[model samples]
Target: MAENAANLTATLQVKPSIFEIIAQKSLNDILQPAFRKLAEVLATNFPKRFAWLNNYCEESFVVINWLLQYNYLKNYDSTFSENFYGFKRMCVDGKSLSNHHIELSLLFIVLVPYFKRKFDKKVTLYMIEEADGYFKQASILGTNLRRKM
Candidate 1:
C-alpha cells in the first residue's frame, strides 16, 4: 500500500508540457471581450477563414483551461498565433487607416508535409504582423494572395 501511494504521488508531481500550459492560459483568456470581438470579425468579414479560426480558438481554449486548472503555467512558453483580419471591416479597417505597417513572416514548418501530401513541391505559411492600425490592409494582402492561388 505504501509503495503504491508513493508511485501515485510521483506520478501526480510530473511536470506539465509547454503546450499544455499555453492551452490552459488560453482558456482563461478565451472569453475576454477581445477574443469575442475577434471571433465576430472572423465570422462577418471572412466566412471561409472562420473555420480555421474557430478550430484554433476551440483548441486554444481547451489547452489554456487545462493548464490553468492544473496550475502548470510556469512550465511552458505561451505563444499563440493571432489572425489579423476577418470578413468584417470593423476589426481591421481602423488600423489600416491609421498608417500602421504590416509585416509578414513566412514559415516553412508544415509546408513540406503539406506539399508532400498534395504531391506538390512547395507550400508556405505566412505570418503577418502589423502596427495596431494597419491590420485591414495587411489582411487585404492575404486575401489577394489567396485569390491568386
Candidate 2:
C-alpha cells in the first residue's frame, strides 16, 4: 500500500505563515474543541489534542516549529510512532502549507487511536464526517489564497 501510494504527489505554493496560522487557529478553534467534545460524548477523560501538540512539534519541520510557538503548545509525545513520520515526506516533496493536508493528516494519526479505543470501529463515520468539514474549509481557503496571488 505504501509503495503504491508513494508515486502520487501534488504540489501547491503557500507561505509557511499560512501553515502557522492554520495550525494555531485549528488547534484553538477546531481540534482542541473536537477532542474535548469527543471525550465529553464518550464520557471518558482521554488525553486531549492540546496535550499532544508538543509531541507533534518535536523533531518536526520548520512549519511545525512555527506552529508550536504560535500555539504555545507543549506536551510529551503521545504513545505512538516515535517520530512525526508523514510530515518529513511532505516537506521533502515541496508541498505548500496553505492547504491543511499535513495538519489533518497528523490529526488523524492522533485521533484515530482515540476513536478506536473509545468507540471501537464505530468511530469511522464520525471521523470521516468531522474531517470532511475541515478538508473543505482548507480547500476553499487554499484556492482563494492562491487565486489572489
Model 1, 1-149: lDDT tens digits are 79768868855654656775566556434443465467668867897868566556544444443444223212221213212111111224443311121111111212232335345322222222334336677677664424444
Candidate 2, residue 24: Cα displacement in angstroms equals: 26
Model 1 worst lDDT run, 10 consecutive residues: 97-106
- Model 2 lDDT tens row, 1-149: 88776655333323334565556444434444454454454443344644444443222223443354223212212211212211222334565332355455455544453445457545877889888988798898875424553
Candidate RMSDs in order: 19.8, 20.2
Model 1 deviation from native, Cα RMSD in Å: 19.8
Query: Which candidate has the highest TM-score of all?
Result: 2
Following a full C-alpha superposition, what root-mean-square deviation does model 2 have from the true structure? 20.2
- In model 2, the runs with Cα more than 4 Å from the true position are 1-87, 91-93, 96-99, 121-149
Please list all clashing residue pairs in model 2, or write none if there are none: none
Error of 2 at 3 (Å): 32
